[model samples]
Target: METRRDLRGILFVLVVFVGLAVIWRDLRYDFNFASDMHKAELGRRRETITQTVTSIALQTQIETQTELTTEIVKLSEDVSPAEKA
Candidate 1:
């Protein structure tokens, strides 16, 4: 009867230890998940900023190109018709 009581005590302690380990693992998993989610959001924000800058740069290039084209047209008109022929 004494051995049986000792065995029961050991089993109860083992069960408690296993439960604690599971709880710790679950908490660790949640923390890692949150960290990864935050990193992803930051990456998305960076991408958006990069895209906006690129768009602005492209718009400026287009405006400069248009101005250059207009100047070329004006210079061509200034040339004599005989020179064009």
Candidate 2:
């Protein structure tokens, strides 16, 4: 019974070590894969962000110009021809 208990303890420790090794290996691989993907996508992400910002800015400018033109037209209608002369 003592020998059997000693064998069980050794087996338990060995299994725990094997499990830890497997977990560490998987984590290392995942970290490396994610790092590589980020490096690959960095430029594409930057370009996409820049394009989106530029598009938003241009749309804002157009809307502002349209609003200003409408206001000018309204003001012109309120004024008389003599005001222009």
Candidate 3:
């Protein structure tokens, strides 16, 4: 014994429920995608930090080698041939 007004009310409730389900699904997908992007960003930052540290260490080593070479050359100039005999 349902009237036309009751039928219309049921249809409205069904439409709202379907709309909410669609919105929930879309948000879940968006959250998962955002999480993946965050992980990738963290990995990239770690790599960049590692590369910068290695570059700084290599530059320091090279500078030390150059300084050592210069010091050896200066010392050699002071040596006399008589000292070698």
> What are the TM-scores, per candidate, against the unseen true structure?
0.55, 0.53, 0.55
Segments in model 1 whose C-alpha atoms lie over 4 Å from true places: 1-34
**Which runs of model 3 end up more than 4 angstroms from their true locations?**
1-34
State each candidate's clash count: 0, 0, 0
Model 2 lDDT, full chain set = 0.61
Q: Compute the lDDT for candidate 3.
A: 0.59
Instruction: Give the Cα RMSD of candidate 1.
Output: 30.6
Compared with the true structure, all predictions reach lDDT values of 0.61, 0.61, 0.59
- Please give, for residues 7-68, the per-residue lDDT of candidate 2 as tens digits: 65565566556555555655565557647676456545545555655565566556656766
lDDT tens digits by residue: candidate 3, 53-72: 55655665566567668778
Model 1, range 18-83, lDDT digits (tens) per residue?
555555554565557647776566556546655655565566556656766887899999999999
What does candidate 1 score on TM?
A: 0.55
Better of 1 and 2 by lDDT: 1
List RMSD in Å for every model shown. 30.6, 27.7, 31.3
